[model samples]
Structures are given as structure tokens and as C-alpha cells.
Target chain A: EDKVVQSPLSLVVHEGDTVTLNCSYEVTNFRSLLWYKQEKKAPTFLFMLTSSGIEKKSGRLSSILDKKELFSILNITATQTGDSAVYLCAVEGTIGNQFYFGTGTSLTVIP
Target chain B: EAGVAQSPRYKIIEKRQSVAFWCNPISGHATLYWYQQILGQGPKLLIQFQNNGVVDDSQLPKDRFSAERLKGVDSTLKIQPAKLEDSAVYLCASSLVGEGITFGQGTRLTVV
Candidate 1:
């Protein structure tokens, strides 16, 4: 079955800490991997990575995909209280343009 | 460009009651999707529509759930005899071919 799994279901870190979240998947006809930040009810898109080894970055957040390894990592540097939210990992396939999402990593950044 | 729009930001109902949620996809987006997200979990795709046709509804619980996009523009999802497990955040998203999807604010449903 096609599935995505994320590690460290929950995490707590102090401000300025650097944290790495992991996502691994097993799916057919992989098209891309995406990361989302969910605060309260809405999930906002963070990054989309389709190429392996190439890192996609914005401000203090960055992510990279490895098609061969079937896994990806999202790094958040100099974290702040505002960074506290559930980080979701999703993998899209070419079959139906549908996304399979992991349970997400709940992150709490302390002041 | 305007983002996807959803209605009734919040809804609370007793179990066995029925409810309907609405969605308006981004203008010009050919693909639309409905997802159910439980607290602390990621969103799960319930259905996907291309234009006004159903591309996928395998995960949708059709027994009591139904959806339609008649004009290929806006869509609605209805749930009859709601269950406690059905309490979730209903998210609507839309995207053009080869582009990432854009999500709406989502509707939070609570069942007693």
C-alpha cells in the first residue's frame, strides 16, 4: 500500500534551536513531495520538492528530497515561538494527482 | 489572484444530524479536492474532481457522503446522518495542472 510516515510525532524546542523533521514514503509513480505548516485549522504550503538532492528554501525553513531513498527532510533553523505548529509531509503521485499525507510532526517552540 | 473560498468557517451539530459544506476553487483551476483532517493528523483526500467530472472518489464514504461540482466551478459536500468520527476539518483545495494546490481556510465541524 502507498503510505507516508513521519518521525517524532511531537517535538519541543527552545527558541533559536535548529530542528530536523523526517518523512519517508512508499508509493508508485512519485511526482513530488510537499511540506505544509498547519496552525490551528488551516494548513499553509511551505515547499514543494520534485528533484532529488536539490534543496528548496525560504527564510529559516528548507527541505530536500531523495527519490532513490524514498525519503525527505525538512530543516527549520533559528526556530521561534511562531514556528510552533504541526508540520505535514505529503507525497503526490502521477496516478490521480492525489496526495498521500503523513500523520504530521507536532512542533512546539518555547520562548 | 483570489484563493479558494469555503463557507461556514465553523459548524457544530449533534450526531445523526446532516450538514453540507461548500467550496469555491480558485478561478481557472481545473482540479478540485476535498479533504478531511482530524485533530493532530494530516488531511486525507476524500474526493477529486477535474472540471465537473469525478476523477477519484475512492476514499469518500459514499454511503452517507456525496459531492458535486455541477458547473465545473464551485462544489458542495453533503453528509447525512453524521457520525462522531466524521467530526473533522473539511478542507477544500484547487490547483491547475502541474502546479501545487492552494487551500482555503477550511471548515471545522464538531459533533456531539
Candidate 2:
């Protein structure tokens, strides 16, 4: 069975703290891994990592993929109250190019 | 460019009722996807369409759910006799093949 799992189902951090969210997957023909930040409305695209060891970054958010380990990590630095949202990890597989998503990690940044 | 568009941003219906949601993907995107997201979970793909044709619908509950993309641009997802478990956010997304998907402001469905 193809599946994606995320650790620390929920987290709480003070403003200015740094946090890491983890995602692991078991699927055939792994194509790419993506991270999304979902607020109350719609989930916004964060990053897409297709190669191992290469990090994708934007501002305070960064992510890396490990195809060999079949896992990925997303790091958020200097967290702010605005960063309080659910972070979702998803893996896309070559077979049928289906996307399997993890039950997101909910992070709450308190001020 | 305008992002993906979905209609009836919020809907409340009684169980066993029928309802429909619409989507208009970003212009020129060839692939469209419909997803169901229950509270505290990630979105689950319900169907995928490519240019008015169905690429996948294996997860869609055909017994009471049906979807169609007309003219390869606009799409609609309908649920008949919706169950309580069907209360969820219906997200519509679109992308070029092999690209990161763009999502719309999903419709929140509440079935009582």
C-alpha cells in the first residue's frame, strides 16, 4: 500500500522559535515530494523537492527530500504567529502519477 | 494570471440531499483535480481529468458522486444523497503535467 505519514500531529511553539516537521512515505516509483501551507481557507504551495540532498527554500521555510530514506523534512525558522497553519507533505509516484498526501502537521505559533 | 476558481464557497445541506460544486481551472492548464478533505486530514484526490477526459476516478464514489469537465476548461462535481461522512472541503486544483498544482479557495460542505 502506498502511504504518507507525518510526525508530531500537532505542535505548539512560541514566536521566534524554530521547528521541523517530518514526513515519511512508502510508495512505488517516487517522483517528487511537495509541501503545502494550509491556513483556514486554501492550502498554498510551499515547495517541491524532486532530488535528494537538494534543498528548496523560500524566506523562512525550507525542505529537503531523501529518496533513499523515503522521507523528507520541512524546517521553519524564526516562526511567527502568522506561521500557525497546517503543513502538509505529499508524494507523487510515477505509477499513474498519483499523489498521496500525509495527514498534515498542525503547528501553532503563540505570541 | 487568475488562479483556479470555485463556486458556492460555502454550502449547508441536509443528509440525503443533492448538491453540486463547480470549478474553473487556470487558463491553459491541461490537468484538473478534485479532492475531498475532512477536518484534520490532507486532501484526498477524488478524480482527475485531462482535457475533458477522465484520467482517474478510482477514489470517487460513483454510487452517489459524479463529475465532469466540459469543453476541457470547466468542471463540476455532484453528490447525490450525500451522507454525513461527506461533510468536507471540496478543493479544486489544476496544473500543467508534472508541475506543482494550483488550488482554489475550496468549497466547505456541511451535511447535517
Candidate 3:
């Protein structure tokens, strides 16, 4: 079975603080890894990492993948209350178009 | 472009009851997926449809959960004789091949 695990199940931080969430996966035929931010409703796409070492960034959020270690990290810099959300990690496998997801890391940013 | 659309923002039912959720994918998306998200957990894929065809459903509970995308565009998922354990948010998402997925607001199901 394909599995994805995330560390630091929950965290609390003050505004302007930085946070890093981690995810690791074990699966065959790994194709890509993705990060998503979910607030109250559904998840919104953050980044898709297909290659290792190269970083994908947008505004205050950035993510990088380490294929050699089967892990990925999402970094949020200068966090604000609006950044409080559950960050999810998912892995897509080449076999059968399946996506395995982690349990997610819930973040709370207080002003 | 418009994002994915799902209906019945929330529903509450008793065990042994039936409930259905609907989803309409983006105009040009070829792949659609249904996911179940329990409280404090990430969304888990329940089924995937590629142009109205079942691409994957390994995680779906076949005995009571069913889904169909008859026209290859809109889809519906039904759960019969729901159990308390089935309470969760049902999220619908769509994507083009090799593209990032766009999710709907989701239908929150609460089974008592």
C-alpha cells in the first residue's frame, strides 16, 4: 500500500513567525508530490514537485522535494492569521493513477 | 475558468439512511475524483473517473458506496444504509492529465 506521513500533526505560531511542515512517502512508481492548503472547506493547490532539489515558491509559501530521501517540506515565511490552515501532502503513483495522502499538519497563526 | 461544483453544502442523517452528493467538474477537465475527509485527517480518494470511465475505486466501500459519471462530465456518489463512521466531508475534484487538481467546497455529511 502507498503511504504518506506528515510530521508535527499540529502547531501554533504568532503572526510573522515562520513554519516548516514535513512529509514523507513510500510508494512504487512515484510520479509526483503535491502540497495543498485547506481551510474550512476544500483544499487548494500549493505546489507540485516532480523533480528533486528545485524549489517551487509563491508569495510567502515555498516547497522542495528530496526524491533521494522520499520526503518533502513546505515552508511558510512571515505567516499571518490568514495562513492558518491544514497543510496536506499527497503523492501520485504511476501505477493506476492513484493518489495517497498524509494525515496533514494543522497550523494556527494567532495575531 | 470556473472551479469544480458540488451540491448540498451540508446534510445530516441517521444510520441506515441514504444520501447522495453531486459534483460538476470544470469544463475541459478529463479526470474527476471523489474524496472522503474525516475530521482531523487529510482527504482520501474514494474513486476516480476518467471521462465517465472508472479509472480507480480501490478505496471506496463497494458494499454500500457507489458513484457514477454517466455523461463524463457531472458525477454523483451515493451511500446506502449509512453508518456513523461514514460521517465526513465528501469533496469532489477535477484535473487535466498531469495537472494540479481543483477541489469543490465539499458536502459535509453528518450521520447520527
Runs with alpha carbons beyond 4 Å of true place in candidate 3 = none
TM-score against truth, every candidate: 0.97, 0.96, 0.95
DockQ of 2: 0.71
Local accuracy of candidate 3 as per-residue lDDT tens digits, A10-70 = 9999999999999999989998999999999799899999999999999999999999999
Q: Global CA lDDT of candidate 3, please?
A: 0.93
lDDT of 1 by residue, B62-105 (tens): 99999999999999999998999999999999987557778999
List of chain A TM-scores, every candidate: 0.98, 0.97, 0.98
For candidate 2 chain B, which ten residues in a row score worst on lDDT? B94-103
Per-residue lDDT of model 2, residues B51-85, tens digit only: 89998999999999999998999999999989999
Tens digits of lDDT, candidate 1, A1-111: 999999889999999999999999999989889999999887899999899999999999999999999999999999999999999998888876778899999999999
The superposed Cα distance between candidate 2 and the true structure at residue A74, in angstroms, equals 0.4
